[model samples]
Target chain A: MAAEQGIDPIHQFRIEPIIPIHIGGLDLSFTNSSLFMVIVLGLACALMILGTSGNALVPGKIQSAAEMSYEFVGNMIKQTAGTEGMRFFPFVFALFMFVIFSNIVGLVPYSFAVTSQIVVTFALAILVIAVVIIYGVMRHGTHFLKLFVPSGVSPLLLPFIVLIEVISFVARPISLSVRLFANMLAGHITLKVFGAFVASLLGAGAFAVIAPLPLAMTVILTGFELLVAVLQAYVFAILTCVYLNDAIHPGH
Target chain B: MATTETAGTEAPGAPHEAAFPPFDPGTFSSTLVWLALTFGALYFIMKRVALPRVEGILQTRGDKIRGDLGAAFKMREEANQAAAAYEKTLAEAKAGSQALAQETRTRVKTEQDAKRKALESELNEKLMTAETLIADKKASAMASVGQIANEAASAIVQHITGKPADMTAIAAAIAAAKV
Candidate 1:
């Protein structure tokens, strides 16, 4: 048996630079995260290109898949943000496809998860909030402030309500980013821990007979992680649409 | 010894430090840059190429469906018009045949009336001719009977005492007897 490495489930999230580059004082380098992002982009592009290449009146399998995803995101935006919000269709669609591809690709044996990093998820969340703020300001101007103050409230309770609303509004990006990051981090860690358990048990020879328990758990957790990956991506996109709705309409 | 050795080699930080790299500030800038590049590229491709094509296909399918429905509706209207026209023609034909039958009946009645008038006139002429012939024959027969009566009276007179009796007297007697 190979030497037993410690049950270090956190080792997978490590960022190793593939091509280290230094610009002035900034350490800008290509990484496994970057490579996986490119892979996700390639897969998304290839699926679209090959799927719609025929553009048959009656669609083939891949064409149906491509159309299904397009309509899925389109309907999500329409439901959450209304028709006017469809102006940001490309942005929402891109975010949905990128997150979904990243989550699914990270499930591959040795692939890195770009969404597992807080910087990426936080950046996406900030981008969504930034769009909402910018669009709200542009569209509603001074009336956008009404989103912070609920209607039908007395002057005495108004201040407290506004404070709570402000706190929740500011916490949108934090919650959005953390929700996805924590889910992926916890799921990957659990899978790795179970996998390490199986490895260690097998290495012990006599306990190898019990390795199937942790192995079975790893398998089940893997299935669960796959579900989480899809669900988290969908949740992220839906939240983005909901946030964007406030910008489009401004008031309640 | 094995646990310590594995821990030392695998993780350089404390046990908690190695678990979460997202809090690490050193790699944040690089990760952000890459994330921006990748997400920007994905957004551009989706907006410019991938999404447009899908939208185009959907638009074309929608247009085709609408056009087919319109064509079908138009064809139905045309069929309805043709059916109306056929019904109109059939009604006209029935009306024309009814008028022709009425004309034939009137013409036949007129001809029969003219023929019946001509036959009655001809039969009246024949009856007049037969009555005139019978009158003429009765007059001639009475004249002959007068002459025969005159001759028989003369013979009887001769056979008796006197030679011949007067014919006028015998005719007068015959005339009186006919009356």
Candidate 2:
């Protein structure tokens, strides 16, 4: 069993620098995660260029796919946030494509899952929260504080309700970042474990007879992992909308 | 802590390092650097390419909608003008038809009056001719009656006195008839 192979799930989160590069006494090591980030960015840029180069009304394949993605994000924003919310459409759309693209690229062989890291997810979530907070305050002035105060509440229950609301408001970024990071990390770890099982079973002489079963399960897990990758990205974007909703329309 | 140490001792290949030491991602700074690079590129694309194209599409769509609405309004105005002109022409035609009918009636009445006057004059001439014939018949009948009486008287005297009456007797009888 690979359990004896001395590779634990937590140990798999190890970071290794691909290239040693330093600037001004900073340990700026280009790691595997950084490599995946570059690849994801390249993918995004390539897709954009290909989708727009033709720009045909009738739509070739790339144009149609791009148009579909654009309309999908546009509709999601409109449905959740309304027409007034379309102002944030570009940000939300870009976030969705970037996260999804990174997750999918991480699935390739010898690739590092950048979204599996807390730093990346936390940074994105914090940025979204900051934007919402700033936008709410700027647009609504001091009344933006009302986001933590439910309207029409009895004075007796107001304090308790406000306390709860404040806690929930503060928990938004933590929950958003953790949800995406945990899903990505757990999914990749599970796939890695199952893949190890299939490889080890096939490598053993007598247990090679049972290798096909684990191999089939590994294949199934791969499909499920792909679905999770896409779903995690979707969940992250939808949470952003929900948080932004609080900013745009305060309180319960 | 002692339990974790014992487990690590039992595990032959496990690292002997402390578990509490937070992972110093020596590459964290590098990740940030790369992320900044990518983020800058994305921001550039958003500001330069993607955002502009999307905005252009929306603006052009809005202009098309406005232009179509304006054209429709102009067409409606033209249609209304055409309708009004058609209505005016129809009214004028009705007025002309009415005037022609009135003139026809007036002319017919005048022609009917002239025919009636001619008929009346012809009837008056026939009535005067009848009256003159009746007066001539009356005068001739009176003269004939006087002659008849004179002839009868002469015949009677000729039978009694075997002689015809004289011209003076005939003249005296005509004068008595007149009285």
Candidate 3:
């Protein structure tokens, strides 16, 4: 019961560098966040390789899981971005697997959550938006700006509508990154707070009998957080696809 | 006591630092670098290895299914053709058997008519012989009946006269009586 003097819930989010490396006066040191990322990459790659290694017509469990994940992302892209969008299937699949793996791996006790950090999520969102903008311009030329202009609008309100559209368009990456970060951050914090409550109660001697309440709550919250973890990743990937759809099709 | 001391030492360090380290800009560059590196690596793996293998497996499975369905359809058509051929042969056999039965029936009828005609002619010949024999028998019986009548008439004449009747007279009387 180290919770005798209360617990610091924010301590879990701290970035402590594992290997300190400096280049050109910049701290490019590998941190706990980076370590977890490497672990996720290894796990993701291992799952795909081992699962598909057999490539049996009648699939084993691992192969089934691997194929199911492949179809899931493939279908998501096909539905949101159409068949033409399948060209980006690898990128979207990577983003989805990385986010989901990062979120799930973070659920392990004492593990650092990569997605909980704003910088990591923001970088991903920016990558998606940057691809969308670059490809939209290349494919659709100047007509890509039509994304801001609504069809069948009165000339009187056209400028106003365009302005609103532009603002929302610019806000895409911010909202995309923030939504994932906030959900993961909030869920983990709530879980920690409840865990600390249980610990504090257990340390209170006579009040120890009621410790099961917060403990039960923490267990339930953990289950809920797991769902949120997978769901937030899906949301991020789906929004990326939708944004890419605008790039490919523009306007409508 | 240890937890309290650690918490106290950490509480005085930052008055204006953001409550969440994620909001702190100090580690942004490093986080970005790692994200780019890991994501790029994962993307490369997905593109190079994982997806193509899965896609190949799916394509093979799809082709197998289509091939099986096509083979099944072809087999069904072959079965249908075989059944049709069997039915046609059955019908042809039935018609051949029917024609053979009809020919046999007509031949048998003609043979029976010829035999009946020959048998009727033979019976007619036998009936004619029987009629001739009956006519001969009737003539002999008539001759016997005439002789018996003459003898009885002569005996009765002799008894009444109490003398022998003359041959010539008797003969003449018998002849006149016969006439």
TM-score winner among the candidates? Answer: 3
* Candidate 1, B-chain TM: 0.54
Question: TM-score for each prediction?
Answer: 0.76, 0.65, 0.81
lDDT (tens digit, per residue) of candidate 1 on B1-179: 11111112222232244446666656665666677778888899999999999999999999999999999999999999999999999999999999999999999998998998899889889989988898899989977977787787778867895656777777788789778
lDDT of each residue in A91-183, candidate 1, tens digit only? 999999999999999888678888898778888888898889988999999999999998989999999999999999999999999999999
| C-alpha RMSD by candidate, in order | 7.9, 9.4, 7.3
Q: Is the docking of candidate 3 incorrect, acceptable, medium or high quality?
A: acceptable
Give me the TM-scores of chain B across the candidates: 0.54, 0.62, 0.66
Report how closely model 1 matches the true complex, as a DockQ value: 0.25
lDDT of 2 by residue, B1-179 (tens): 11111112222222224341112334445555666666556656754776556445445656878999999999999999999999999999999999999999999999999999999999999999999998999889977987787778788778888977785877797677679
Estimate, for each residue in A110-185, the C-alpha lDDT of model 2 and write its tens digit: 5777788776776678778887998899889888999888889999999999999889878988899898888888
Order of candidate numbers by DockQ, starting with the best: 3, 1, 2
Model 3 lDDT, full chain set: 0.84
Name the regions of candidate 1 deviating beyond 4 angstroms. Answer: A1-7, A204-213, B1-19, B98-179
Position B80, candidate 1: lDDT = 100
Candidate 2 docking quality: incorrect, acceptable, medium or high: incorrect
Could you say which candidate leads in DockQ? 3
